[model samples]
Target: MKLVRKTIFWLHLGIGLLAGVLVLMMSVTGVLMAFERQIVEKADGFHITATGNPLGPEAHLDGLRTAKQPPSSLGFERDATRPVVYQFGKEKAVFSDPYTGKSLGNGNTAVRGFFKFILSWHRWLGREGASQATGKAIIGIGNLMFLFLLVTGVFLWFPKRWTRSGVKAITLLQKRLKGRARDWNWHNVFGFWAAIPLLVIVISGTVISQPWATTLVFHLAGETPPVQGERKKPAPFTLPESLAGLDAAFATVKSSNPDWQSIQLQLPFAKTATFIVADSHRGRPDLRRTITVDLATSGIVKSEGFDDLGPGRQTRTWIRWLHTGEAGGLPGQTIAGLAATASAVLVWTGFALSFRRFFKKRRAAA
Candidate 1:
């Protein structure tokens, strides 16, 4: 039993040290991203009062199509006050009033840049192209290590005997401890409390980074994973004489869900394409309602609500919400943010204790 405990301790220490920097970066960036949407909204002055007399989707489509280079997609803002967003070829997007077809200009660049930087480092270690791919692979592997660390950390936190005193010693931080002892207590106490949320966050993160994990999720849910590029292609057809179908399709979805908070329309690139509408209510993105319309016929191809999704897909959506704490709204975000902050502390304390022990061993040898 003693040897087993020692082995687990060494394994925990080794893995933690190996993945410390990557985990630290992820935790710090996660803390920043926990409230990112709110910050960006504030920075961009996003609030707009809706005018009941808004124009139809066709006008917005025309306005975007007539631009210097036509946008590949158009996102209709469900909020009557907000401008519809037109996304050009990757990375370029502009907002225009849905009622007037007038440009509202791009949003605050500085704010966008700030979030972009955070996201890049959070996912790709601030690398680009091939290096970014490599960084992502590293981060994914490190996340696995981090997940293992969480499990072993709890095991190491367990006291020799299960008693009221033993429980209190591990659960509460001792104020009187100094140096190494203080760091050890801080690491264990925080680890014990932060374990569950961090585990959820890490597992969700791994699911996102690994395709096999996603497949496993689907298998567990008793559903087959969707194959890539398997969407049935629409029969070849020409552009409609008038883009009235776009407006008609938008109305169909809006009339169905009158209380939808926002609806983003993705204009199809092919002559035979489907208009993909992403709907959400009350700022809860995890509860997205998707409606697909055939461009050729302007007919509703499919309308899927959150509840209508198969277990595999539904689990995927929930995993994303869990990772970002969007599932629980503001309170969820607060908990996820706090967990990330505690994780940073755990990394710091772990490093401090490891280094102190290392130096002490060397001193004793001398």
Candidate 2:
């Protein structure tokens, strides 16, 4: 039994040392992203007055079509104070007033850039193209190792005999301790308390990073995983002289859900493409709704709510919310942030201990 415990301890230490830097980068980025949505919204400075009645979706599209370069999509803000936004190409966006369809300059590029930079590092280690794929693979593997470290760390943190002193040593930090002893106590205590939430965060992250794990999630949920690249091709048709269909699709979705927090209308990529409307509920991404409309007929093709999702898709959605700590609102975000911060500390302390042990052994050999 003692030998088994020793093996687990050494395995934990070795894995921690190997993956510590990547884990630390991920942890720090996770901490930053905990409040990213809120921070970005505030930084965007997209405010408008609610005095005048807002124009209908069609009218807004008509206004946006007059831009020097037509936008590929339109975003409607549910908040009356916020202006409508038009997305051009992939990353550029323009803001406009909902009341009069008047231009309000560009969307918040600085905030968008900041978040994009952070997300690139968080998701792909700031790499691009083939390197990005390699980065994601590394992050996925590191997340699994991180989960393993958490489990082994808990085992290592268990009290030897369950005595009061032993329990305290594992559960509480001793403030009076200095240098290595302080770090040791802090690492153990923080790891013990943070094990559960950290487990959840890492598991969800792993599931998202690995395609096989995603399939496993669906299988466990009693549903068939969707096959990749199996979308039905749109029926061939002629392009309309105007974007009247886009407005009609938006109106259809908005009329059904009057309380929608925001709506994004994706323009047809091809003449046969369907117009897609994403109606997101305020602060509740899981509850966001989707609608598809035929490009030729301006008729509703399909509309889906959160409850309409299959078990597999629903589970994946919930996993995303859980991973980001948004499912539980502010308190959940706070917990996730603390867990990430603690994880960073754990990496730091683990390296410190390993180096100390290495030097001590070298001196002893000398």
Candidate 3:
């Protein structure tokens, strides 16, 4: 029993130490992303969203082909409330906007910087030349280490037996007396309560990094695979195009959802571009729902809500939401953020304890 206890403790402490630096970086950066939307809204004075009006995915593609600025790839999207949004990426340029085809400007905006930095740190540790797979592997390994730490930590905190005295010893907060026990109590108590959230976050993080996990989820949940089509050269939309006329497109879609208070239009990158719009409900900034429209045909193509996502997608989505606390909205995010912040403290204090132990062992040897 003593040997098992010591083994778990040593393993927990060693793993924590090994992954401490990376975990701290991920936690700090994760905290930044938790309030990113609110922060950008206050700083930029604008919230880029989409319209729920249905759009022709093919027409959007056609418009792009004619524009001469056709993207290498495109993705349809919508915010909490808005019209359809199109994302075009290439070797040199990446454009994001509504299907009505408004160019919001380049990708170098200040608000985008926050997202870029947080993502880079979380995924790559900001290390240049590191492949995404490598970054995810490192993060995945770290998560597994944390899971192990959680298990061992629970064992360490468990009392030797179920007697009343042992139970009191296990449950009592004697940290008030100070010294090693105090730090140990804080680490164990906080760890015990925070275990579920921490484990969830790490598990979600692993999914992000592991393709096998994603594939397994798709098979298990029986989700439809993501739509993927070929990309061709750009062909700009013809004049009289008015880039598909923003006002008419907006009015047509807005009539469908009167509950929406604001709408943002994005221009197509090419003639094939679709009219994308987005809307929000209750004034919150999450645009998990949206509608799309085809510029040429002006027909509905896709309508969906994040809440309505399929099981396969939701598994990962919910995990990400749990990680960022966005799944439950503001309250969920706040709770998760606090947990991450606590984890940072744990890492710091854990290191201090390990250091103290190391020095004590050396002193004893002398």
Candidate 4:
């Protein structure tokens, strides 16, 4: 038992040191993005009137046509009073009047751009083109190591004998802890509290980062997994010739989900329009629904919600929402943010302790 603990201790310490920097980058960025949804929502002003006739996407786009670049997509906010927002790409966005379809200039561009920048670093280390793939690969490997550290860390945290002092050290904050002792206590305390949420965040991120993790989700659920990266991404900014489908698509989706809190149309220059509605922004997966409307015939095509997904696919979907803490809503995001903050501190203390051990050993030998 002692031998096993020693082996795990060394492994945990070694892996944590190697992956500590990558973990720090992800954790700090995660903390920054935790309240992103709510902040962006408030910044853009999404207020849906309980009673009012809101204009369609075409009405909103009417004013934006004279812009330097045509909007790639147009979406309806939760309420009629709010302006409809359109995006040029991931970063640039413009809001238009719901009544006149004229451009209301732009909505929260800095905040949106800031979040996008943080997200790029978090997922791909802000690398672009072919190098982004390299960034993703490194991050994925680092994530795996972090997961290992988390598992072994819990084992190492448990004491051989649970005395009152030992329990307090693990579960309580010791006073006036200095230098190496301070680092040790901080590492254990932050790790002990953040362990659960960090596990969820890392595990879900693992599922996202690795294709095998995704396949495993399906295999465990006894369902056939879809082929990875099979779908060819269509040109993002392709503007449709006709804005006629937007109204029909929005109306059909609204009828399907009368109690829907928000809806956004993924503008595709196609015979059908896809509308995604949610009970809250970036949260509540169960209350979320995707409805497709046939633009040509102005008929309801198909409506699918969380309940409609198969168990395997549902679990797969849950992995994504869980990673972003969207499945559990605001409380989930808050926990994730706090855990991420704890992770940054963990890395700091871990490095501090490691440096102390090495220097202390050298000094003693000398």
| Top candidate (TM-score) | 4
Which scores better on TM-score, 3 or 4? 4
Residue-level lDDT tens digits of model 2 in 284-314: 5566766776656766667777788899988
How close is each model in CA RMSD to the real structure? 3.6, 3.6, 6.7, 2.9
lDDT of 3 by residue, 208-310 (tens): 6766766776777888655434547565433233445333444555676555554434333332323323353322334435556555565555655656667
Whole-structure CA lDDT of model 4: 0.81
lDDT of each: 0.79, 0.80, 0.61, 0.81
What are the per-residue Cα lDDT tens digits for candidate 1 across 1-366? Answer: 999999999999999999999999999999999998778667766555565577766777665443455566677665565667777655777877666667777877788788889999999889987798788888899999999999988888888999997788778999999998899889988998899999999999999988789999999999999875444644433334577566666677778667666666654533333444444533354556677766567676777676787989889878978998877778889999999999999999999999998987899899
TM-score of 1: 0.86
In model 2, the clashing pairs are none
Q: Which model scores highest in lDDT?
A: 4
lDDT (C-alpha) at residue 132 in model 4: 86
- Name the runs in model 1 displaced over 4 angstroms: 47-52, 78-81, 228-241, 269-286, 293-301, 364-366
Ranking by TM-score: 4, 2, 1, 3
Q: What lDDT score goes with residue 313 in model 3?
A: 78
